[model samples]
Target: MISNIMTMVRKELIDAARDKRSVMAGLYYAIGTPLMMCGMFMLLIGQMTSPEDLNIKIENSDNAPDLVKYLSSKGITHGDSQSTNDKGDQLDVKDIRLVISDDYAAQMAKGLSAEITLIADNSNEKLQKSIRRLERNLQTYSAEMGSLRLIARGIDPRVVQPIKVNVEDEATADSKGGVILGVATMTMIYAVFISGMNLAIDTSAGERERNSLALLLSHPVSTRNIVLAKVFSVTVFAMIGLLLTLIMSKISYAFVPWQELGFTVTISTEFILLMLLIGLPIALMAASLQLFVSFMAKSFKEAQSYLTLVLIVPMMLSMAASYNIAPDTLQWLPVSGQQQALIAFIKGREIPMLQLLLSSVTTLIIAIGLTLGMEKSLKSEKIVFGL
Candidate 1:
């Protein structure tokens, strides 16, 4: 029986390998997604890390020369629409406008409150960080001037500062990198599903359509052995795709400027091994599920449609884990559970062994159930021939 299953597995693999559609489906995602993800991370990191100088329009600067000097010292400077940096590169000027009220320095002589108007589109996402920095510096200058005034009147400046706030961050560098890793991890997890999808459908629905499934089943092998063979073949293809994805990610991710985000994300060898270990059961479940769904469909086109919809289930689970949408229940669920454990491992946290074990067992059980169902369904002429 085992020999029959092995022979069936070899046959299925060779057949899938020769199918251009099946081979290309895994190749594209395994090779392409990591490079694409690397490019996206580079773009995001560039935006998050500011250049040495931040240029914006500052009107009526003479009204507060001291304030202007303070801002300049902090790398915030006034620039016209057409401004170039020392490198002769055109400066990317922010649209923020800071208008210093023209009171002719009269408010300072009387120790009274001064005013400044900042104009910009508050709803603009790109301008939010710059606007906040400008506001913070202005507040600092105001507080300093107020302290001088209190001292001049023989009052302690400390009287106004009744409370002092200090923050201590306890997060490790790995934990900080977790925010960036969320999406990266999601793409890797989905590799198992994507890499074997076309092959799973082809080996089942495509085989049936070509009048080959009936021939194969008519052989001296038990239906269970045939089901196991198909599942094993698809699972092997899925694992290979997953391994390639991890290798590509490891190579490509090194070029990203993770330091700009105040952390680093090195896909360590240990993490790679852990990911593979966890992914095996997921690959099996994916193969079994896809094969079962494909066998239930009458034709190749019908199977393709069904699998597309079926793929959404894993995607949703992965998405929820990535965005942290529903952590409480997802931590115990199948795909999401493994995802959370992977994320935890990436962040240098201890692996949640219980959850990992539970999820792996659950995933294998699902695969077994699906394989058995497919085996039972294969005996029915109506299901096998789509009559």
Candidate 2:
């Protein structure tokens, strides 16, 4: 059995190597995707840190001298103009500013509310939060001023507010880390699955379509050996892709200003090893599933269609899991569990060894089951024969 498996593995490698398309697909999957993802993550982190300078236009500066002073004290630069640059702009300020009309004080004194136009660049989501902060601060300042005026007029400020409440987050550091890592984990899964798909399909369905499967099957080799050989080759390529991604991610992280962000992300050696240990099983399972599906198809194009459907499973699961539906019973789910685990590891959490064992075992069991089923299909003349 060992000898037959070895022979099958050798044949699969030779065939894969000779096919330039298959070789290129493997290289791209194993190396290209990871590097791309690393670049993406770096960009995301950088944006989170030092956002672009916002150009803000504040109109009707005469009515809200206090508000203008407040904005100045916060070091938020703004221009006083009705039409700063663009009218269609969402916020009246480029970053976070409000424009008061020329008749603002007259309208307010007549028991009428005045209109404040805000122009902002909505493209930067981070800027929106800053705008909200500025607005909240202004609101508080206005309320405090009104309260002092009422007190001076012999009125109690407490009469206006019957209740007060404060909210706080009691979540642990791991849980908070989990939230950010979850997004990244989902992204990594996407990169790996997409990058690995073509290789998986070509290694199996492409081989069958080129009449290579028939030649391989005719040899004195067990079907299990053939499947294992193909899986191993595909996994090798997948690892290369994943490694390239990690290296790129590390480079991007290194270039980021960690002190400015108030937190450091040091990708440790141990983390990489653990990631590989977890990612390997996922790649094997993905490749095996694709290979099994490809074996059922008559042509490479048909196999490609089937593989595409298979790709959606991971993506859908990733999208759903990204919302972090919480680490409850659903955390034990296949793709969901893997997503949770990867996030837990990335955020410096000590993952439960049992969870990793269970996930790995479950994935391998499914892959082996599928591979065995494919073996049975291969032995049948009806399925193996081109009908």
Q: Assess candidate 1 and give its TM-score to the true structure.
A: 0.90
lDDT of 2 by residue, 190-299 (tens): 55565556777776777777777788789877777878887776776666666656666556556554444455555667766766777888778777888788888877
lDDT by residue (tens digit), candidate 1, 36-83: 999999987786566557798999999889989999998899998688
**Residue-pair clashes per candidate, as listed?**
0, 14
Stretches off by above 4 angstroms in model 1 are 49-54, 73-75, 121-133, 167-172, 261-263
Candidate 1 whole-model C-alpha lDDT, 0 to 1: 0.89
CA lDDT for candidate 2: 0.68
Q: Quote the positional error of residue 214 for candidate 1 in Å.
A: 2.2
Stretches of candidate 2 off by over 4 Å are 29-35, 46-57, 72-138, 154-156, 169-179, 190-192, 257-261
| Number of the top-ranking candidate, with TM-score as the measure | 1
lDDT of residue 289 for candidate 1: 99
lDDT for every model? Answer: 0.89, 0.68
Q: Which model scores highest in lDDT? A: 1
What CA RMSD would candidate 1 show? 2.5
Model 2: how far is 311 from its true place, Å? Answer: 1.5
